[model samples]
Target: MNTANPQLEGLYLALAAMNRLMVEKQLLTHEEIHETLAETEAAVMKNSALDGQSDSHRKAVAFPIRLLMTANEAAERGGEPTFEDLARQVGRTS
Candidate 1:
């Protein structure tokens, strides 16, 4: 397990708690939570790259960040948030 970043660990913990809470409240099915978590983790990992890049590359990177923000918002609202939802919200459609 990587513990190099406390903030990332904290986010993982918070996401776990959210999953438990959603399950307890019946806001999300167990499978749905599991899938969402997996997708979220992948998205976070992909966006973790911070290589120096051109302005165009940075602009492209913003797409994932925006999708993540939308996903977080939807999760907070107890909505049935999924990777598809995030993609659609960000106009990525994928």
Candidate 2:
């Protein structure tokens, strides 16, 4: 969790915040977001396979997917999950 670049961390926070706002405004349901994230993740993984991408590359690409999925899960559980906490969960889950 050594974030050598601050912008990467900012992007993660921004994504999580955007998802939270969308759910809060009822523009998108938590279930909808979760389903979409799952689909996206599957597609990314499939493409990675086809392209013969390295495991490190695949995991790096999956970070945002995991971040969004974690955000949606936190929304469903009525919990405010931090970016660091979500990032840690993503690593463990991955």
Misplaced by over 4 Å in model 2 are none
lDDT of 1 by residue, 20-69 (tens): 57767989766675467557645644565445455455445455445545
After TM-score superposition, the amount by which residue 66's alpha carbon in candidate 2 deviates from its true location, in angstroms, is 0.6
Clashes of each: 0, 0
| Strongest candidate by TM-score | 2
Please list the residue runs of candidate 1 whose C-alpha ends up more than 4 Å from where it truly belongs after superposition: 37-94
lDDT (tens digit, per residue) of candidate 2 on 2-77: 6686787788778878888988898998888899999999999889989999988888898889888987798789
lDDT of each: 0.56, 0.85
Q: How many backbone clashes does candidate 1 have?
A: 0
Candidate 1 lDDT score relative to the true structure: 0.56
Q: What's the TM-score of every candidate structure?
A: 0.37, 0.90
